[model samples]
Target: MDALDASVPAISPSRPFRASVVTFRALVGSGFRRYATYRQATVAGTFTNIVFGFLRCYVLLAVAAGTAGAMAGGYDARQLATFVWVGQGLLNVVGIWGWADLSERIRTGDIVADLVRPVSPVTAYLAADLGRGAHALLTRVAPPVLVGALFFPMATPSRWQTVPLFAASVLLAVVGSFGCRYLVNATAYWLADARGPLAFWTLGSGVLAGLYFPLRLLPDWLAVTLWVATPLPGLLQTPLDVLIERDPPALQAGLVALQAVWAVIMLALAGWVQRRAERKLVVQGG
Candidate 1:
């Protein structure tokens, strides 16, 4: 009896943790391998980024010249050029594509399997998304950084002291951006038509996140409103400010704090919605 009992399966409470770790590793590995196979797309993307970087620089220079402005948002013409170049390069690293959502899963009933997994849905999704970002960083960010460096004098921290702070800020920006997207995706739990909401969020993110232009150049009231209400400015604009070494300590700290707060709030909201979604899951059509 003792020998037979020793052969029986053992169920541990930590099974979920072990499963999550394995899932994360497999997801990241597959993402890396998949990205490596897309060599042509990566090369083309790098060239396209370089062209756009130069074009944006030319446009900004023209604007500065016409206005006879010393700077807008604490950037000279050359500095602004560098900012645009870096921003475009980092765009892919930041997962500009909004792909994480349970809509497709729900539509196809694929989420049925996900629901059975030992890992939390949000954590599983985050692991997969981080894997994708890792691939993009290597394939997309690196080449553009090289090309932009050759063409423009990109901004660097004035002192080594800022490097740690900059790194911390970028990390927080990643969390903030991911959190906002996760919240947007979670809305599919309630609305049958989430496409419109997703589109609206994307457009709003572009404007408020300062992806198209520096937030500082925006109208004062509009900028203030966005900074307070959305996570956009913290993601791209704050990183740019850190890179340019122009932002005051107080402002940078405030932005980082805002990013942390948003990340926590969005993550909490996503968890709540996900739990509610489990009970609401309905198979409507084949």
Candidate 2:
């Protein structure tokens, strides 16, 4: 037989899409299993949460004592307590460490393999993040919430209406935070050294995002400017506000709008960087 007749035909199917689904499923399953195995880490996280919550509560109580019962930034003792509780609890679920290893993947050429996957790179990355978030919420987030409930009675949402609103706000916060991190991580494609950039961005964003403290305590103009220019408020501050404060509809709507705007901008930037990186890979064999 001729060579062509003797040889079996290659069986190649669409792999990128299938590969992406496999990657997502593997990440989710691994995250669930890893979470089960990390009991010590989970306990340590709980202890840390308790310690920080105690310290924050103490500081707030001391400040309140000096303020002579006057409310600060629309939060009284009870509301402030609730704020700390919610903030600390949500931190775990928020996955605020930023895009896990996206920068490293890009810099080390692993992104080349990722780019060949049939799924959208963005979607795949987000699936991994969601897995982490799920793990944290089940372990870390629960401890803070339980501790808060035992130690302090928070203001429960008065109406059922608030539940959906809070849920929506939290969803937007997650998306906004993910987009911001993705944007920052994508800079690795262009920058020779991205650690410094990542550090600077993380610190600035952390401060503005209310990961450490509430932005309501900042000067009005400064808070407004940061909220408008950055994705920080949408990620932490806005969600916290919705969870604790009874913000007017105008403010709530404004925050949501800002989140949408930032999501669009960051997504556009990430897409542009990713396309450029893909071209570079084609030329340089990354």
Off by over 4 Å in 2: 1-37, 282-286
- Clashes by residue pair, model 2: 16-117, 16-118, 17-118
lDDT of 1 by residue, 253-285 (tens): 777777778767767777778888888777545
Q: List the residue pairs that clash in candidate 1.
A: 209-232
lDDT of each: 0.71, 0.71
* lDDT assessment of candidate 2: 0.71
Q: TM-score: which candidate is best?
A: 1
lDDT of 2 by residue, 58-93 (tens): 687566656755566666777777777777877767
Instruction: Compute the lDDT for candidate 1.
Output: 0.71
Where is the poorest 10-residue window by lDDT in model 2? 4-13
TM-score of model 2 vs. true structure: 0.81
